[model samples]
Target: MSGPCSRVDHMPSENPFDDRLRVRATEILRELTGHPEASFRDGQFDAIAALVNDDKRVLVVQRTGWGKSAVYFVAARLIREGYGAERGPTLIISPLLALMRDQVAAAERAGVHAATINSSNATEWDSVLDSLTGGDLDVLLISPERLTNPKFRTNVLDVLLDPSRAGVGMIVVDEAHCISDWGHDFRPDYRRIGALLDGLPADLPVLATTATANTRVVTDVAAQLGDNTMVVRGALSRDSLRLGVAPTASAEHRIGWLTQHLGDFQGSGIVYALTVSAAEDTTRALSEAGWNVASYTGRTDAEDRARLEQSLKDNDIKALVATSALGMGFDKPDLGFVVHLGAPSSAVAYYQQVGRAGRATDNADVLLLPGTEDANIWEYFATASMPDEDEAQAVLSALSEADAPLSVPALEPLVGVKRSRLELLLKTLQVDGAVDRVQGGFISTGVPWSYDAERYAAVAEARRREADAMLEYEAGHRCRMRFLAETLDDPHAHDCGRCDVCAGQWWESGVDDSSTSGARRILSGIGVPVEPRGQWPSGMATIGVPLKGKIPVDERVSAGRAVARFTDLGPGQVLRSFLADGAQDAPVPKNIADWCITVLKEWEWEERPTVVVGMPNTTRPVTCADLSRGLAQIGRMTDAGPLSYTRDPGSPDVNSAYRVQNLHGAFNVDPATAEAVDGQVVLLVDTEIGSRWAMTLAGRELRKAGARAVLPFALALRG
Candidate 1:
């Protein structure tokens, strides 16, 4: 098997630095670095020479801070100069918007003209294209999504490919591991690159670079690039990273340890969580402890994400509590430390994330505090990666049966898959040529496709192995660096002199009570806003409901609250298990009820509730009733009784429209309770809010029954 260190030599170059291309590359590198005397590192010169001089496809799998960007920028410049002005600018298929922004700025600093044409710069596309066509740009950066966009592929890429027109010289695929299914962050859109590669001429030099590819990823990526792809690999170890793991008594130890010891680390760094809710909660805890920090997740707005990233890089904050969404190409050199709230499922992924730190500085710390619930999270993501053949067949059948194309939302109820999953499956099928996305959503192309059961099964099995390996690493039997290196198939693997095993545990094991208390206070005290439904979902009429347009003010609920999210680190883990499918139905546990009370007591409502009412469900009716009664007793509010539904609405797996239709007229208030709630602010309680329609309909009933206002509350909000 092919690993990063496994090299396939191409046509060799004569006089490595004597040629004009090499000299210019060196000069360009110097300009980019702002160091006039700076020179190329090992394999940097070779990779640049392979692209610009040898005219060969190349894969560079060096650790972060290895100056892979220099190789590509210099090669693009030389290729543009060698191919002449009539040809198109060298195109780069970058993975992230942040990465593109950084590269674009660096290209300009290197005096190489560059422009981007991704989603963020949609407004600038007309002008960016003009510059490329006008031969004013030397480098063009774009996301892989743009490569598959029909309009862009037709108008921009096709035009750029023509030698008689604005022809192309070279292409760069940054974060190339994304091309492999074996890659931890495999993206379907990045797979579109194979089509782009096939369309390019045989002589066109291509380069793929990544810092996290294992043997499987490298082999898969190389095969995609075809024969004669030169591999330039480097050591995975970062001497500056002092790897260590702090074994904790409980999963909750992460936050406490972070709260107490974050300042102990040398410089501002990152605290990574597996989920967005965990990151946000961690950010809040750190900020509450007077440690300056911000939450970074996929949900963070584009502009705000950009601003937060800058703040972290500038060291204005102690750290950014972030999820894996913050991974890949987040350039922060001189980062003081890297800490994980929980271990990632695969060692490769863990290494990739920790690799972000200590790029420019010496003696940066790397710590892992594995959690009890990490295995559950790993299993969830593992299953999510494997496509269900039954679901895929359902999607294909639905599309084929339809007379016209159906949008994601339109097809949601029909296919019985969540919108996000459905969208992903459609993209996967589009890649398989079973469906095509046209002007108005997606339509079936009548292409017969096999399920490929064996392939998907194998992928699922690999995920299981990765998870097993991650568990062993967390157990800390061997050197952490050695374990990761061996896992990644890094040929030069050995026990590092650092890490918990070799160094005999550097960080403390037990967390202090003060920090632990602070964590409990924050975790138990936290509650997320539940935005009220403002408008009726479209296609409600199709689902046997007459509702349409914005919901009237009186029928709508005020913003509500949930005691804790399923992703919260404190009671979230316990609460999740407590709320699981086969979990015994019982009254709300006193401890959880106490936390719920804490959430309500801390919630600053405009009008305090005087009454409490529960939404009954067969699954956990006792819990729901107890929650309402427990709150009513503590707050000295009256128990206004349960909202009665005429019939079952089934599970909340249906779309918003179906959900609304199912619950719209199902809830009702009895005469005695209708009189009891008159002009009183009521707290509407439920064990969980899945569709939110149940709470919406219940709140509407209470409002119509002369309640002054309805404030919805739930133990958890399922999305």
Candidate 2:
């Protein structure tokens, strides 16, 4: 229960390994780093020796870019040669495929034969598996998610567990903090480590390492690691970092600042954002302003991610605008800066991410641009991960009552949980022995499942506390690095005399008027594509909508337009404020209406709309009508008026199937409007686009009544 680095100082001066293995380790390290001067860092030898010589379970909490991978890779190499063992390759349970790719490359460079099995390289899995089991590989890198595979558990893990024939040498769990629910970014797939450990031989010698683990996370991981766990913790402070908080008034100010001053940032680095939307928004704005940047998000393709990561390392790009997806195991030793558009929920998480920069540089700039939505976003993620009692009970009941295992799709509608969330709950329940995932899907274990509401509540409270600590850190009165260090319970948490607070404000918080105006202008110009849904959701028939498969070509609306996406960094923010929750219904502001007109004029459709017809809006009828009338009055087009609702089913936030169902009998064309829209290019206007079904259904009706094309356009859109 002491500080994270409390016992780090107790490591002996003498090397734990004898001269022979020590020398081999140094050789492997040199080869891996491509530097003859590369040597063991502090506590690195102790960790290597503990795993190879002492046969111990070691938990290493070291800073990023501190050669944690070297400890394992070198140890794996030394043991394979120094010891009598000849065959079993070390198995690594890593979280990201990106990390695995990097590790594999490093291993090859180090003359350590390593192969990986992950989702990205499915075509190579069989060959990799053959190499691993055929005693041709030194290290077998596997993703934690793949550990739950029934065949993999039987084929790979079972084969590796044999201590005699193709026996296990060691197991490495990178990003070890994921094993604990108390840790930031806890993953249910990581809990499978405990099960894997239970199945392995006791003396197999396991190593777990992470750059971010506070005292609480350490305790939880140590408990799961079982007895005789030696935590080789190292100091958390990074001397190369010059930290600061910009404390911008809004996301817009942050975007504008980056536009004007990103080139002023020292070198190629990272600009972190809280959400994928935020990252993409920044990427688009910065690129438009001529900053060399690329967006890296969870939704990004793996191939693109690899290319972008290399671009950053080579300094081909000024920065990678990214979410936490870019965190952990990304090694760019000469990275010159790390800027955050929004503060991370936990100081520990922030430190881990910022630590990615300034690792090998003399002085790297680190700045935080805190946002108002940080707390709400933090709370949303924290609460979303916890399995609620009602949801858990529903899942258990559904599985128990079923005669056979139900697939996720079958359980989805039955339990009323989203597919991704449902899978997470199932995994958590599987780990807790409440349910089992078989070949078919999921089935109950017929065991009593206790809902630990208090535990989850405590975790949520801890997350909120972390958020408050982040807010305090951003206030900029205290040394920023020291605040983060202390929040992570670092033993050495004193001021480094390098941050804005310690050396007087080092970052420019104010954005120039010209830059702000330019950013707004560019952002407002970016329009979101409102592509029509070409096919009805499959389950619409079950929902009594009587629609399925590809939508009729004639009934489909043409590609549509929205002035901006709510997730966009520029005009999107302004549009969001106008339609934000609790705002009173009003007409479309003239400024926005003017921009919409600009977008329409700029859109080079094959045929321009000769008429405008508004979707009847229950919540914002005035705004919808105003937008339509404004566009018509400006374009010299005929106003066809609003489409009346025959049956109003107002569940705009439901699933696609239910949304389509709600729209089955929802709209009927007004007699005059129908006549006006018949056999002409019609512009369908709405205040904003949510599900797009309302507009889709209404357009279908108009097209059925013989309109040439229904051009759907909205004032704003959900990103």
Candidate with maximal lDDT: 2
Off by over 4 Å in 1: 1-18, 83-86, 521-526, 529-600, 604-719
Q: How well is each residue in 1-719 modelled by candidate 1, as lDDT tens digits?
A: 23233373333434444466567788889999999899888788888877776667899998889888998888887777763222457889998877887898889988889998875444456777788878888898889877657778777887678768757778899999999888878888888898778767766788999988887788899888867788888777777888987664454468988888888888889999988877877787787688999888766544456777899899998898888878888888888898999889988899999998999987889998888888888988777765779999999999999999888878888988966688788888888889888766789999998888888887788888888988788888888888888888888778888877888878765568887887876666667667677766644554467887778898788989987777666666668878876578898888888888778888989999998988867788888888888899989999977888888875575445556767877887988788878998989998887657788888888898898889999998664
How many steric overlaps are in each model, in order?
1, 0
Stretch of 10 with least lDDT, candidate 2: 1-10
Each prediction's Cα RMSD? 8.7, 9.5
How do the residues 1-719 of candidate 2 rate in per-residue lDDT, one tens digit apiece? Answer: 22222244437535335777677778888999999998788888888877787777888887787788998998888777755344367888888867887899999998989988765554455677788778888899998877777667777877887656768778999999999878887888898788778766667788999988998898888777777688887778887899988764577777889888998788899999999777866787787788889888876545457778999999999999999989888888899999999988888889989998988878899988888788888877887788878999999999999999988878888988976688889888987889877787788998899988888888778878878887888887688888877777789778989998999888766679877776665545666666676776644554456787778999999999888877676678889889875477888888887789789977878999999999988878888888889999999999989988887675564445666777887788878888898899999998788767888899999999889999999988775
Off by over 4 Å in 2: 1-10, 13-16, 82-87, 518-526, 529-719
lDDT values, one for every candidate: 0.81, 0.82
Highest TM-score model number: 1
Roughly what TM-score does model 1 have, to 2 decimal places?
0.76
